[model samples]
Target chain A: MVNDSELCEIILQYVKDEYLDEDDDTQIGPDSPLISSGIVDSFSMVSLKTFLERKYKISIPDAKATPEAFDSVNKIVALMKEFF
Target chain B: MAYADKIREAYRKELADIRTAGLFKEERFIHSPQAAEITVEFPSGAPQQAVINLCANNYLGLSSHPEVIRAAHEGLDSRGYGMSSVRFICGTQEIHKELERKLANFLRLDDAILYAACFDANGGVFEPFILTDQDVIIADRLVHASLVDGIRLSKALQESYKHNDMKHLERKLEEFQDKRIRLIVTDGVFSMDGDVAPLDVICALAEKYDAMVLLDDSHATGFMGRTGRGTHEMRGVLGKIDLITTTLGKGLGGASGGCVSGRAELVELCRQRARPYLFSNAIPPVVVAAANKVLELVSSTTERRDKLERNTLYWRKALTEAGLDIKAGESPIVPVMLYNAKLSQDVARDLYKEGIYVVGFFFPVVPKGAARIRTQLSASHETAHLDKAAAAFKKVGEKYGILGLKKDQIIAKFGA
Candidate 1:
């Protein structure tokens, strides 16, 4: 089973691969704002929730996947912990 | 009395907060008809300005067509005025029936039922069919707000996949395999980004999952495909969509009615049970006659839609070549991305000063950071109108220093 830091890294990598263009040089840290910063839009945020649910076999409630919860890797990891 | 005063104070503070956050929306009064050029009074009492309109839903530019206006006058003279009741009572007229028949034939569906508006059609469509908790509705994440509210009124389990992501939709279909009925609903074209749904692939997925598909083609009804049959025709999935709800308010003559055209049994079911259809007043006879004329025109020729396509191409190319960030799509809706809400508003306001009529979309209408000025093209727009609009956009874009900037750069500049 993946630990918290590993899960965070995995989510971060998934976001980077799916959302960011290859030429984009913007640095994304663990606590970097995603949704609020225009990095992850609402539709992309739903896709992220789907990815996490499918990968971890955990269903994140819609309420739990709010923009606030999905705004950062740290926050997402915290939200994921509830389901795990 | 004291409670009313407290409520008033609360609302006053809320409105003040909206203004403080630069999110207050102001309306523009249009003096002329909704066409390529319109006279507008901004901020209520300001002097009127004739601006090149880029924000209306008049896709085929039939909103103020002379033929359509004549048809409305004829309808008014013939059908009297109001229905005075709902369809179940006395609102159903001969012209209404004829329009419904013609619409179903045009849409290539078995039958159709009219509603007061597309919002009413959407709100009433789901509840009648998806009757049990065993059923499920899997929809695109970025569907219109009407669908959201409609889904909320249904008893079925509601789910959403990523927008236009076939793989994600397939996974959702896989996960919900045990559901009694899986209804997949999507807009024919997403208005914000001007992207068409991949209905061909969506239909295939629905077939594989043994599900049904419902399409809301409000944005693509009159000018999306080769023969103007909407996205289903454009995507080569004609007759595959189980249900289609569309508005007469947009591409279909810019009137005030909507309809649910679909399989015979489903439409009959809505006719019998859809609350909005059974209760709301029938569409005005004038609108019905005008819409009938519209369908007749679109059915005969592809002239207007073709012009719209060419105009869209020219406008999009012009904006892109002028170094503005434009969302790429096939529809006439062109979104000029301005990521920051205040930046979008400022750019739109400046463009208005340059005699271009447009509005900035921000949070609540769109996502918070995905703010944009959605510029729509019409067949009414001539080359001169498009040229002038593009030049105005370029001027305002330069004023905001947003020309040629990438998304990240824009965000970095404006704090999105």
Candidate 2:
């Protein structure tokens, strides 16, 4: 079972590798505001939700697939825990 | 919860979420006419100083050209304000036909037909021309929202390749060859990034697959090529596209009209069957007349187009030298990419405070973390205006620390 920090580490790598554009160079922390900081967008969010569902075996219902649900690594870990 | 109440409560939650996410769209109304300089009101109700306008689609600066405005007046006098009827119901005027003829000549197409707007033209195109089960519509993933909606409305099977990926397009074309008809549609110039389509490759692929090509050259039609005949001319595929859709809202006169122009039979088919062309009220005579004047001006001399290209190159260089992460583009639309959404908004606010008017683009307008403020150059923007805008950008960008990679980050990324 993946712990919260491990989950955060995974997400941080995913964001740096996949979501961030070539020109962007912002540092990502557990508390970093992904959406507000413009490190990710709606498409990125959708991709993240899919990643979470696939990797963690936790489905994010459409209602819970919002910024409030996972705008930060901490929030995403918390959301993943709800299913666990 | 009761059914209606639950629905209302769900919608209320969604609205609240949008506000929290900063994705809610906000509008700013301009106080002056569309030009190089205009006044606008901020959301706080404070009157902003006259700003050097850089956000408009006024490519040729004909939005407020004296000649175009006078032509509008002349048109009003000679042809009246409006027809107040659909084209089939006594709305088609002699001026409409004349404008269509001029558009055909301008595009070097065999014929042309006018529509309410390019959006309507896109909406009406696929349904009439290729609405069948075996008819496949292949599009670039980033084609305009209007074209996507049009494709959705048609019964044709839809397939999209990666944006501007010719290899992916070839694969899709090969896979869909078993389909009876394949229609490939793409934008001549994608508006968001100001990137010209690889029209030459697309045309060649169309020939190989025996497919039809449609180019919505809305952003390119006014002043893109050597003689401003749009993407086809720019790409050296002049008069090769099967169908073309373009707008007057941005290019010609900056009023309102659009046309589906191309080969005689294609245009004639659209004129006879396209819903938007048949049901929508005719293009107002004044707008048609103003557009005619704009076309006349464009045809007579390449002066405005030349000036616009020069302006685009100058400021793109200026902004890059100033250390802003400006996208190097050939078109007049230059985007200053700010990865952080809040930073994008903050930078735009600071620029506005410095009397430069540009809007921030975020989220759905572009991919996530790719927020930008698109600045459009016009022939009307003088050197002084360009210098002022660039200076303002430099100032605000420094304050926000948005200019190129910081010294420390640069060292870290590059390894001193």
Candidate 3:
């Protein structure tokens, strides 16, 4: 099972892999705002959810996937704690 | 500062943020009618130039059809310019009922109820019938904003499955079976990527779970399937779906109106209780007549749909061959992916200068990093029109050094 740090690293890596524009090179941290900072968007958020679900072997309820709950790496960690 | 001043400051800051994030929306003026070819003025409101229209929802090429225009004029003369009241309150016209009946017949459903627009039809459908707390609504996450709002007002326990993910839908259905009622809603064709929803699977899952299905076919109604019966027909799930809502503002003559077609019971209840129908003024008679005629055209001959299908297939092939990144789908909405938002905007602007009209989408509209220039094809576009549009895309993509970069390669190259 992936710990919070491992999950955060995986998420950051996945986001960098999937959601980077050619012009964008900003580094995202665990406490950095994801959705509000425009680092993750609606589409890529789904990718992140799927990635976390697959890697961590957990289900993310619809209520937990809202911007309020999954907007940052730290929040995602909190949500993971809620489920796993 | 006063509260009003603080409010203004908040609004100003939000607007500035949007601009800074490169997500501010700007509309272009069209000097001519919506068609496959149109004259659009510069954003500066300077002299307009003719360009092949590639962004309009005017599928099947009926928006400016001579017959539809003639019918509109005739309806205005025979019926009146407007209805001052809602359908039940002194606004019921024989033509309105006729259009509703024809729409129902076209979709092979028992009945259809007209709304001022499809947005209204979607808005008004849920709240009247469902006891908000007892009913559960499961929707595809990518459904139109109108449907999303409608579900919200319904007070139903709403859950969203991933867009077009049938497995997620099945899981959601299994979870919602304990609820008194289960309704699954989805768009027939997602307007952005143009990928069709998996309706056959949805119907199968709905049957297994004893749930009803609602399909918003606004993007597919006039040009999909063997007989243009919308997405249900295209996916061979016709006569299985419980409700279908569609717009006349698109493929059906590009006029302004919408309708919800379903079982007789649902239609009857919606007629009496749907707020948008009961409170809003009736659709104009001219638009009703034009929409009715458009239905006739689509139902009688498959010529227009056939042309549109050919155009879409050809354009998709051309773009694919040109090494541009596009979602591989049969629908006419072809999103040419340009990962960089600024690049997507620049490509759209350059394509416009090259006489092709399309719109660029960025973050907040679509997901971040999935920026694209969405291009829609109409049956009215000729060989020359499509060839020119494809050539313009190629020229622009080559100029920017942004072409053929697949999903995996996007971040590495553009992550800079």
Best by lDDT: 1
TM-score of chain A of each: 0.95, 0.87, 0.84
For model 3 the interface RMSD, in Å, equals: 6.8
RMSD of each: 3.9, 7.1, 5.4
lDDT of 1 by residue, B302-370 (tens): 999999999999999999999999999999999999999889889988989988989999886787678
For candidate 2, write residues B293-347 as lDDT tens digits: 8889988888998999999999999999999887767888898877666767888
Measured with C-alpha atoms, the lDDT of residue B368 in candidate 3 is: 62
- DockQ category of candidate 1: incorrect
Comparing 1 and 3 on lDDT, the stronger one: 1
Candidate 3 lDDT, B1-416, residue by residue in tens: 46798899999999999888676777788888888888988786678989998998989888889999999999999998999888888998999999998999999999999999999999988987776656888888778889987986886766677678787778778866778999999999998879999899999999999999999999999889988888899899889999999999999998798999998999899988899998999998999888889888988999999999999999999999888989888888989887777777888889989998888887667766778889998999898899998899999888877677776676566641
Choose the strongest candidate by TM-score: 1
Q: For model 2 chain B, where is the 10-residue window of minimal lDDT?
A: B407-416
What is each predicted model's overall lDDT from 0 to 1? Answer: 0.89, 0.83, 0.85
Clash pairs detected, candidate 2:
A41-B368
Clashing pairs in 3: A22-B414
Candidate of highest DockQ: 1
Q: Name the runs in model 3 displaced over 4 angstroms.
A: A1-84, B1-9
Clashing pairs in 1: B323-B404
Q: Write the per-residue lDDT of candidate 3 for residues A1-84, one digit (tens) a residue.
A: 568788778777766655554476787878888888676545336556755765677877767689878787788888898887
